[model samples]
Target chain A: MEFEIEKIAQLSRLSLKPEELKKLRKDIESILGYIKTLGDLKTGDIEPTSHVLDLENVFRKDDVTRINIRDEVISRAPCVEGPFFKVPKVVDKE
Target chain B: MEKQLYELTLKEAIDVAKAEGPWEIIRAVIDRTALLNPRLNAFVRFEPEHFLKKSRKSEDFKGVLSGAPLSVKDNICIHGCETTCASKILRGHVPPYDATVIRKLGDAGAFFLGQCNMDEFAFGSSCETSAYGAVKNPWDIERVPGGSSGGSAVAVAADMTIAALGSDTGGSIRQPAALCGVVGLKPTYGRVSRYGLIAFGSSFDQIGPITKTVEDSAILMNLISGFDPHDSTSVNQTVPDYTKALARNVKGLRIGLPKEYFVEGIDPEVETKVREAANVLKQLGAQIKTISLPHTAYAVAVYYIVAVAEASSNLGRFDGVQYGLRAPGKNLLEMYFETRNQGFGEEAKRRILLGNFVLSAGYYEAYYRKGQKVRTLIRKDFEEAFKEVDLILTPTSPTPAFKINEKISDPLAMYLSDIFTIPANLVGIPAMSLPCGFTEKGLPIGVQLMAKPFDEEGIFRAAFALEQEIRIYKRKPKL
Candidate 1:
């Protein structure tokens, strides 16, 4: 029925101040308590629904065509100037 | 002529607006919106000038919807227009390109009336979670129209627009349609292109129509059904003329009433409406038979695990570094945390957390994998049932629309709103909600029709027939 800011922030990959965490704990619990109904069902023989109807292996050819938007795509990339894909440092080697 | 468009199907109303100028009709919608939207909260934004100009020259212009007013749920991207998805995170974020559906609708001559409100990021069942504000029902201003497509449904119900398009994942389209007393069809998974729709659950997400009648919905669906290479998941199939298939003849076709669907917990009124719809099918010469979909009970549970798991991964892209608004902070990690912490609403954060836990290294097998396996069993249940019948029947939700504040405080209550409708999304089949009946309090009840994958024709034929037989088709929302 209750949650801690530290635990939820870790689960959600978010960071918050002590006060913010205190607020988040109540909010997360309020939301989690609401989502918890799925746990009460006797899902035993019942199959869970992943896709409404079944769609299996819809295939497409592996043929490669022109990188159609070569110019437009490269031109629009945010912080890029030349023919390279530039991205902010996302991960650091531990 | 200005009385109400809610009383007419989109086709008839469009024809009338075409023969006559759309000025009168559009004005009437605007007027009603003024009187009604104060309580309904159906629209997130409006551009009366653009809509009027298009309607005046409707005949001179060309497209299937020619000046037929339509609202887009906040998520569907429109070039130079906001696609907020009722979330503050995307507040003021406008897409540079039109979602494929937006382009199609625009090309087809449909008037884009502006965005409709919804649950934040399309994450909640009731419209209450929206950052803008919760949308109240047209039928009863205090009650919700159901969501995440609540505003779209409310617009159609309140006559703010003739028809609207909404995205459905786990009954977002159909549940709201049921609550608002309209028709909503979530086509087979790949039936409509998902090119520019904001994702919640990519595998289950689909754009569907919310309209006054089955035939009108068919016309709209036909225009949007063809494959778009832009969306890798869009199916390339021959787009059938759905309207032509509605000949009021579904005689001798097998109709399956899954016992699991009719079990306890469904409100008595909802059960009555669904049962009465079954009787109508029988009278029309279809053989009604009871069938067992043993896995029905697990639908909501499995849906949450898999949907949240996908949601967590899908939502990961919303980090501060990528796009949209961000809170300035020292260091990259602070930037990411601050942006997301301030950006996402309560429900979205909860899902991301739950998704993280379920999809984490240790618990992935028990929650995500097991949910998938159970999903397969549910699919098999539908498969076995389909062999014995052409269609399955059930109530769209456990009850008619609940009050706005009633379930918004409890996320579990909101998820349960999807219990009756999620099974079809899980199996990837076409399902629709047809206005079946109303409760004593005058709220709408929706009867659902589900058919096998790629067999949308059966669904259309059934809903079209039911629309004709259901006496409530002529009734308009009291708003």
Candidate 2:
């Protein structure tokens, strides 16, 4: 039951300390070990159930019915600058 | 000699409000909450003045639930109020708009008392993972209130609020309600709108009521269950007046006791109480039969894989973005990693990592896809069984409320606590947990009643019948 805890954490965009990574590896292994029982079930040719109800694409009249809450939404951001969300620079400076 | 206003059931409080006015009822609950909340830790946020303002405005709204004091799980957005999902990542993230259920509750005149505590991102069976703190079971403060909706259940059980709303994505509602000795209903998937609920397991989540009695559950369901254009998945079916389903008769109704649920590893008392509940229903003219949901053994495994996969994807939006917590870093990816790493609790991190692992490229077919396929088998098992029985019965939890720190370290053990309740969420059916009896140590035990998808009416009728016969609702915790 080998698991790449660091790789998974990196994929999940989560930083983990060495000790935390060690613990998580053991925990995920046992959890995955238990989850391995699913492999025994003969689900061959069975259609996957993503949603229980037969969901069709829901459409509505193409009319503007939503109220604009721009300020209200922007007010909740951790870093806001005049109605816009401020984030760390994505590109490196030359 | 009369009951305190805070101690009255939702129906009784409503009746009293008809003559006495709604303010007095609100005050009683406010006072009760102020007095008991220090010990219970049920509410993550309880501001007396905030409730007073809502109650004042509620005076003019003459809706069906005029002036009812309710506690909401922290995950559901309340517009202008912090909706954190009990996770630190979203600590200050107030929503710009109300969740559809909040709007519905407001229109019906139900005012919120405060946000209740829960497992961070509704990840654990024990409410221990909440960022605010663990919600102590009203029955025994040392024991955990069943989780994700633990605080909601505690508030109802302890009379902190008349009734509260909780979201169930694998028994977040019913399991806690059972451990706390109250009524918890997880309505059919898409039966209740999930418009404002912070996503955990999208396909499985449904917000329902936790209340002191079955009738209160019915009353709350009527107000909240409906089609919502806001939530695309919300079913467009006609919502029934669930209050009409509380007729005190289970005459000739067939109830199935799934043989798989009654197996070993269940607490002897829980098994006995559930069986006793079945007999009580049988005595009242319902036909009782033994049935099997053969795929039951794989439910917990399938649920963790499928639910966490959905949860991992749904949670990706919280990466130092438009709202919630942001971490400083030289690079954007570093900020994303730092924010999530610092923000999520241990349980939340574990689930997120597992979720990504299963959905990762090579392992997708092995874990996530297999889980989805096996989930179909679990659903088909119920579909076949429902043809023979009107409702399925089982213990809501394997045992009574456990000590606070008992299984928090053991994630697998904690996951198994939801074994019986997980199948209902996996199958997307309506199920309710009602107080059936108590263990010798005075801890509450719950028996579950599950009905076919969209048939909450059947569950109500049968549960109401059992509740009336047992009169367990009359027994309150001596907190």
Leading candidate by TM-score: 2
Candidate 1 residue lDDT tens string, A1-94: 3344466567676776676566546655654444454455445665444554345766777888864545543443333447654444556668
Candidate 2 per-residue lDDT, tens place, B192-248, comes to 999999999999999999999999999999999989988999988999999899999
Candidate 1 CA-lDDT value: 0.80
Itemize residue pairs with steric clashes in candidate 2: none
- Residue B103 lDDT, candidate 2, scale 0-100: 92
- TM-score list, all predictions: 0.88, 0.98
Separate clash counts for every candidate? 20, 0
Compose the digit string of candidate 1's lDDT tens values, residues B195-226.
Answer: 88999998899999999889889999988898
The complex in candidate 1 yields a DockQ of 0.28
- The candidates' DockQ values read 0.28, 0.85
* Candidate 1 TM-score to native: 0.88
Top-lDDT structure, candidate number: 2
